[model samples]
Target chain A: MAFEQLAKDVPAYRAPGQQLGARMRMFERDKDELRKLGVPIETVELASETKHYRLASRNFYLPRLGFDAREGTARPPSKSAEGNRPPEVTFSVEEYEMILRAAARAQDLGHPSIARDAVAAVQKLSFDLPIIDPESTEWIVPTPAAGDSVILAVLDDALQRHKTVRLTYRSNEHGVVSRRDVSPYGLLMLRGRWFLVALDNRASAVRHFRVSRISRAVVSVRNAQRADFDVPSDFDIRDLSEERRAWELGDGRPISSVVEFDFSDAVAARGAELGERLTSGRASSRRFAVRRPESFVRWLLAFAGAARPISPHAIVSAWRAAAKDAYANYASADRGES
Target chain B: MTKRSADSASDQLNRVLIALAWLSDGQPHRLRDLATRVQVDERRLRSDLLAIASRTDDESLGALVGSRLSLDDRTVQLHLSLFRRPMALSPRESSAIELGLALIQHEWPRAEAAVAQSVRRRVSRLTTSPVTSSSNAPIHAIAEGMTEVARQSLQALRGALKTSRKARLQYQSFSATSASARTVHPFGLVLVRGMWYLVAHCERVRALRIFRLDRMVSVRVLASPSAKRGDEELRATLERGRAIVKGATERLRVRYSRKVAPWIREDFDVLEQEDGSVVVEHPLRDDAWALRHVMAYGPDALVIEPTRIRDEVACRFKAIARPRPRAAKRRSS
Candidate 1:
C-alpha cells in the first residue's frame, strides 16, 4: 500500500471479512512510513477528496560523482548554503578545525587512496565546516606514492568478486617476471606499502606481493581457458604475515643464531627484549630465530661493531671477512686505489 | 557487543545522511511511501526521524538538518533541510576507504572483517548510484599486526593519556645496554613506519621523546598528574619527525660507486663530487645508525665525519676481524 497502485488496488481487493476503510487506514500507515525515510512523493488532488501519489526519479538520485575540487562539487553556484537553501552543517569551531587537520594530514602522509578518502570526508564535511585555504597547508608524505593503481584495482576487484586473474608478477626475490594464474585472497598495508596475498597456481602456495616493486600495469587477460579457483574458506592472512620483518624474505626452515651486543647506545633507542632471550651484563646477548638466512646475515653485518654473532663459526668468519673487506676497502680508498 | 553497537550507530548515521540528502529538495511526501523506498519499516523509520530531530536539537547537527513534519490522520507531509547539494563519492575515495578497511582487517580486532563489511555496506548504501568500475583496487601498504602485548600497552597508554597521568614505561631501545624503566608523561600516539610510537615527556631525560610501542615491554600508568606538564604538542613533535622521513629533501654528499649512486641519488638528497667516491653528509639525528648505514654499502660508501663516529665504523671492522677468543656457541640451524 506504500505505492499508489497498491493503495488503490487494496480497497476494492480486500481479503474476506475485512471492514471498510480498514485497508485504507493501513495504506495511510504505510504512506507515513515512506515519508519518514525522506522520499518526497508527489500527491495530486483527485475526485471525492482522494489523492494520487508518485515518486519522481529526477529528484531521487544524487549528482554524478567524479567530483573534482577544481570543478566545484558538481553543485551550481546559486544553490550555495547562503541562499534560501537550507543552512550549512555547523560543527563546533574546534571540531571543524580538527576535521581539517585530519584531512590535511591524511592527504600528505596517508596512503594516496586513503588520502583521497579523507578528502572525500572533507568534501562531505565542507557542508558543515568553515572554508579552508588548501594552498596554505603543506603536506609531507615521505614514501613515494604507489604508482600502479590498475594492478591494485584489478587485485581488489578479483578479491571481492572471487574471480581468478592471470597475473604477470615480477618476483621481488628474483627479478624474473613470471606469468601465472592467481586467486588474490586479500590486500594488506605494511610499512606504508600495499601487498597482495594471493594463491599462486604455479607455486600452489599463498605469497604476498609488494605492490610498489611490481614493474608495470597489470594486464587482465580475459582468457576463457584459465581456470577459476576459489579462495580457501579458512584462509587467514595473519598466519602468513606474522613474525615476518620487512627485510626478512624466504621460504626456508628456521635458523637459530645467538648474537651479543653492547646495548649502551642500542638500548637507549630500542630496549631490552628488542630481540629474543634478553640478557644484560657488560655485554647483552639475544638468540634470534631467522628463516631468511641472507637477510639475517646482512642485518648482523650492520651491527658488527655494536653486536656480534657468537656462533656458527661460519657466520663469525663471514662477518670477519666482510669486516676485513670493508677495512681493506676503506684503507685502499684512503690511499686513492682499491 | 560494543563493536556491534558502534557499527549499528554508523549504519544509522549513514541512513540518516542519505535520507536527508534525498529529501532536502523541499518536496513533500507521505512518510510510509518514503520509508518503502529507503527499505525500513514505519516504526523504525519514525524512530530514525525522531533521532535526527533530537540530535539536531540536542547537539550540534541542527544547522545542517532542519525539517518540517505535518501529520493529519491519514496523510503526512515532510520537508528536510538543504545542507548542501548531495554528490556521490569518487572512485578514489571509495578505494581509500577500502584500503583503510584492509589495513585493519588483519591487524586490529576492533576492525575485523565483520566491521569492514558493515562499514562497506553502509557506505555503499549511502551512495546515490553504484560505483561504475568493476575492478577492485588493492591497497598500496601492508604492515605487520601488533602482538597481544603491544596491543595491551597501547590500551594502557591511552588510559594514561585520558587520565592525564604519568606512566612508568619499561622501554627497550635498539642501541641500549638493557631495558630501562622511567616515568613519562604519556601524551599521544604517532603511527609512522608501520609502527606506533608514544610521544611523551620523559621525566628523567627532561626532554620530549618518541618510544616505539612495540619495543615497550611493560608499563604502569601512575595516578598522579604529570609534574610541570605542558600541552602535548603532538602536531609539532610529529612534524619534526615527518620532515626527516617523508621529505628526505635535505642534501648530502655521499661518495660511492657510480653503480649504487643512482639508487642513492634517486632515494635521497645526494650530490656527486669530482672524486669517484660519494660523501654522505646528511645532518642526521642518529649518527650511530648513520655509521652503520654507510657500513651496509660495504666497499661502496663511507662517511667521513665527526672523527669519533668515523672511528666507531673503523672499530666495527677491527672487532669483526679480532674475534675467535671464545668457543663459537652456534645455535642449531
Candidate 2:
C-alpha cells in the first residue's frame, strides 16, 4: 500500500539528503510566516512525543453564517435577490437562489470596480459549491453615461483617500457653470441618480451635488499619503438622501398644491404619503408643498392619466403649460411649424 | 521550472501553504490535478507533498498534514489536521464579498437588509478589515424609487422566475389608455436606467416581451409551470443593451439639437453634423417608445425619418397639448 511504502520512506523524506538540519530550519521559518498571515495552524503535543497540528476552526475557512428562515421565506420573493442565508456553512436551497440573485445584482451594478469585486467574491464563496456560470443570470443595468464614468471613478478614488476634490459643476436652474472645491463625505444613489454628499468649501455647508452635472473633477494630489480632510462623524448620507424628491432639490420657494390621484393609482399616492390625504369623493388626492413646480409637473406627467394636479391654479396651470409645450414640439413638426 | 521555485521565498511559502490548505480536505487527489489546481509544477507539487508527509512527526512543523500520508504513483491522500478545507479569505476577496452583499441590500432593502447585515458582520469578522456601515461605505447604492404596486409586481415577477412559473400582470404601455391583463412566462428581470423590466414570454401575444414594473398595475404568480424556452434567446437580445421592444429592428433617424447633442452623444453613437446637431439611428419597431424617446427630450430632439412614427407622435402630442375644456373652465372659475 502507498501508506506502507510511505512509512518505510519516512526517514529518508525527513532527512532530505545531506541538508537535514538546514531544511528543517527553513521549514520552521516558513511555518512562522504562514502563522503571521493568519493561516490558523495550531500545534499540540501528543502522548508519544509526536506533535498534532490542525486548523483551529471552520471560521478560518468560511464566514460564520446563520440563515434566518423567517427572513428568507417571508415573501413570495419578487423584490430581493438574496434572502435569509444560513449562518453556518450549510446553504439551503432558497439561500442558494438568493446568493445567485445577489451575485447577478452585483455584476450588473455597471461600475467596473464593483463588478470586478463581485466576480472575485463569488469565486471565493463558491469553492465547494457548484460551478456557476454568471451568464446564466441576467442583470440589465445602465452603464455610466459617457463622461459620468470618469466622474464616478474620480469620486470613488477621492472618497477612498479622503481627499478634497475640485469640480466644475453646471447648475440645473441657471444653466451656469461654476467651480467648487469640496471635501467629499460619501456618495449615494437616489431616485436613479448618483449624488455626491460633500462639504462645499466656498458655501461652507455640506450639500449633495448631482454627479451628472459635474463636467470636470480632480482630486487633490498634494497629500498623497495623508487625507486632506476628515468626514464629519455626524454626517449620515441617508438623512440627506431618504425620501428626497426631484421637485425639492431646488432653491425655489415652496408652492402648496392639491394633487388628485385616480382610483386606479390611489394606492401609489397613499404609499408616497406626500402630505395629508384629502378625503375627496371616490378619487383620492394629496396636498403637497412643492418647491419646484416645473419639476413637480414633470414628475406628475409620468403617471400618465392616473394622477394630476387639481388645485392652486399656478401648479395646475404650470402642469398644463408644460404638457402643452411638450405637445407642441411633436405637434408643430407635423404642421411644418418650428 | 516550478512556479514556486522561480517565485520569491515569500511567494513560494505562500503557494506551498495554499497548496497544503487544498490538500487538507482529506480527499485523495491525482498528483497532476493538485498541481493544476495550485498552479504549480507537477514535480514541485510532488516534492512539496513528500516534504509535508515526511515532516508529520516534526513538532515544530505543526503537523501540517496527517502523521502519515498515503502516496502512490498517481494519487496522494493526506490526513490534514489544521489545513483542512480552505484558508481564510484574502483582503481583496473579503472586499468583494462585502461589496456584493451591499449591492444586494441596495436592490432589495426590505428583504435583504437583515441578511446582508448579518452576513456582512460575519464576513467582516473573517476579513482583515472589519465591515463598516453602508452610510460610511465608499459606494452607496440606493434602490430606485418604485410605487407599492410596482414593488409588489416586481416581487411577484421574481418569485415566478425563481419557481419557473407563469405570471399574470396588469400592464399599461405608452399608448394604452388603461392597463390590460396578460399572462406571461416570467423568464428574468433587468434594470435599465432606473426602471425594472420583466423579460417574459407573453402568452397573449405569443412573443417575447419586456414589461416595465412601474407600468404594471398588479402582478400574480400562477401555479402552472411556465413553458420551456432556451435562456439563450433572451440573453442574446439583452447582451447588447437594454432594448425597449425586441424585434423592432427597423431603424429611425432622430436629430438632437446642438445644445443637447453632447449629452445625447454619451448615450448613443451619433453622426455629428457641421451645424452641430447630432443624428442617431434608433433600431425601433414600435411607435410608442420612439415617440416617448423623442418626447423625453422635449424640443431638443426631432424625428428625421420614418414619417409614420413622426405623424403618430405629432398626433399624440396634439391631443395632449389640446387644452381640456374642463381644465380651462376650472381655471376661469
Candidate 3:
C-alpha cells in the first residue's frame, strides 16, 4: 500500500526529506536504483523550508512487461477476404516526387502556410509510398519567424497566470515608443505576422499589439480576472488585418452609418464585409454600424464620385474637411507647377 | 543489303512486325539468331531498319523515338520508349503546375538551390510569347507549396479509391520522438480548410486514425494486402476520432458585467440571465487547457462553473501573483 501510494502520489522528482518516513526511504532507494541505470537527478530548494527533487535531464524508459498471448490474438478477422477486390494501379516514384516538388515550390512562392503544410504532408506520403524519391522532397521555403523564444515564454506565462504584463513596445508607425501594462488574452497570426490581443491597463480597453514590436516584458502582481468574454466564432484574423476599414478602430461604441454606391462600386462592398453592421440594406445604398470610420472613409474616397457617405453627420464632416484639405494641397501643387 | 531493300515493302514490314512481337513477348532473340531466322545477313537487317525508320514519317512517333534512341554502331538496337509515359495535364492543371513552379523558382531559396536546373528546363518549355488575351496572368497567382501538395495528395487519394491496395507508410508525429512504420488501408483523404489529412485504419494501433500526410516520411505499397473498408465503419471511426481529439464539451458558468454580457451572449449560449450579469454555460473536454484559455481574458472572464476549474484557476493566479519571500528580499538587500 505504501509503494502504491508512492507510485500514485509522487511526482517524477522529489527532494530528500520532502517525503516523510517510509515514503522518504522508498524515494531514496528509487533514486539509488535510477542512478545505477545512469539517470541524473537534481535537488533544488523551491522555498525556504522546502526542497524539490527533479530529473536533471529527460529520461527514456521501456516497460519490462510483455503483452499476454490472448491480447496478441485479439485482432478482428480479416474483412478484405470477404469484401470486393479493389482495382490494381501503380504510380511511378518520379511522378510522386514531381507532385511533392510542385507543392514545395508553391509554398516558396509566398503561398499561405496552409499550402506549405499541404506540401509537407504530401512529401511525408511520398516518403511512405514507393512512388516518390524521399531525398527530392524538401521544404522549398523557410518557415516565417514568429518571434524569439523569450516572447513565446512570456506569452505562455502570462496566459497561464491570468496576469497583466507591463512592456515597453516600439510601434512601426514613425518608430513611436510607449510603455503599456496589458492583460494578455490571445496570441494569433495574420498573414505571417504575429499579434497579441490584450486589455490595456491605461485605457482599460482591449487592444491588439504586434509581437515583433514588444521590446521587453515584465509580469505584474495584479491578478486580472477574465470577464465573461469569448472570441467571436466568425472572427477571422486574416479578415481583420488584410484591409483597414472604419470598423477595426477598437472603439468602445458601435456607430451606425449609411452609404450609397453604384454598380461600379460592387468591388468596394467586399471591403464593407469586414466591418460590423447594425441594419444592412441590400440595394445601392447600405447602412452599417462600424467601429473605425477612418477605414470606411478611405474606402469611400477610393471610388471618387462613384460612392458617397450620407448618414452619421460626424463622419461626413470629417470626410468633407479631409477632402477640402486635399483639394487645397492639389491647388497649391498645380499653382507651383504653373 | 541492296537486294533486301529492292524486295517488296510488305516483306520489310513483316520482318519489322515479327521483331516487335518478339520484343513484347519477352522472348530472348540474339541479333545473330534473329538475322538467321529472318533469312537475312546482319547488313541486310540494318537496311530493313533504315526502311522502317523512313516509312514511319509520323512526327509524334519520330519525337518519341528521338527521345529514346542512341546510335553507336552500324548494328541496330531497338529502344523500348513506350514504357516511359509523361503525366497528361489539362489546361487548368498545367496552369496550376506552372504557377507552383514559378513560385518555387522565384520565392523559395532552398527550392531554387535544389531544383534550379529542373526549373530552368520547365521554364524553357513554357511559351515565351506575352499573354495578351487574358487580363489575369496565370503566373501572377500561385498557391502556397503546402496547399499545392495538399491538392496533389487529395487528387492522388481520390485516384487511390479505384485501387484497393493498402499503403505502407513511415509517419512522423509532432508529439512522438521518431517516425514509425505502419500499414494503412487507404480509405480517403479529407481537406479541412487548407490542410490535407488521411483517414485510414492503422495496423499497428489496430484502430482507425487520421494522419496528416505532410508528416508522412515515406510511403510504399505494401505486399501484405488489406480488405476493403466499409463506408459506415469508416464514418464511425472518423466521428469517434474527431470527438476524442477535438470535441471538448464541458459545462462552464460565468458571471460577466453588462458591458461584457452582450459580447458573451453573441458568442455563446447563456445558461441563465440575472439583473446585473448573465451566467454563460459552454462545453469543453480539456478542462485544464480550457480554464487556462478562459483565464487569458483576465478579469473579463470569471469561472463560476465546475468548482474544481474555478479553484484551480484561483490557486494558479495566487501562486504566480504572490510576492517573493522575505529572505530572498533580504539577500538582495
Q: What lDDT does the true structure give each of the candidates?
A: 0.54, 0.61, 0.46
Cα RMSD (Å) between model 2 and the true structure? 11.3
Model 3 C-alpha RMSD vs. true structure (Å) is 31.5
Evaluated at residue B324, the lDDT of candidate 3 is: 63
| TM-score head-to-head 1 vs 2, winner | 2
After superposing all C-alphas onto the true structure, candidate 1 shows an RMSD in angstroms of 15.3
Residue-pair clashes per candidate, as listed? 58, 14, 45
For residues B1-333, write the lDDT of model 3, one tens digit per residue: 001212433334334433333233233446665454444576656665554555343343444344433333433345653321111121223333444454334333343334544543442232122212211122123223343333344444444544666777777663343568888887665433223467777888777776776666666665555566656654543331131232346666665544455445434557555564567665554464455444433344556668787665555444323436879999999
Candidate 3: docking tier: incorrect
Candidate 2 C-alpha lDDT tens digits along B1-333 = 011112333334444555665566667889887765555578877777676556665453525454547778898876656544344554434554554565555545375457656666655555432122321243354533665566567667767877889988888865565779999987778777666778888989898888877778888899999977667766655633564555666898998877677567656888998889899998876665576567545445677788887766555445545646887889999
Among these predictions, the greatest TM-score belongs to: 2
Docking class of 1: incorrect
Across A124-217, the per-residue lDDT of candidate 2 in tens digits comes to 4443443333433346565454457678779977886688999998754344689989998867666556778788998787666788889999
- Worst 10-residue lDDT window for candidate 1 chain A reads A134-143
Put down candidate 1 lDDT per residue, A265-290, tens digits, no spaces.
66322422556774654347777666
Scored by lDDT, model 1 comes in at 0.54
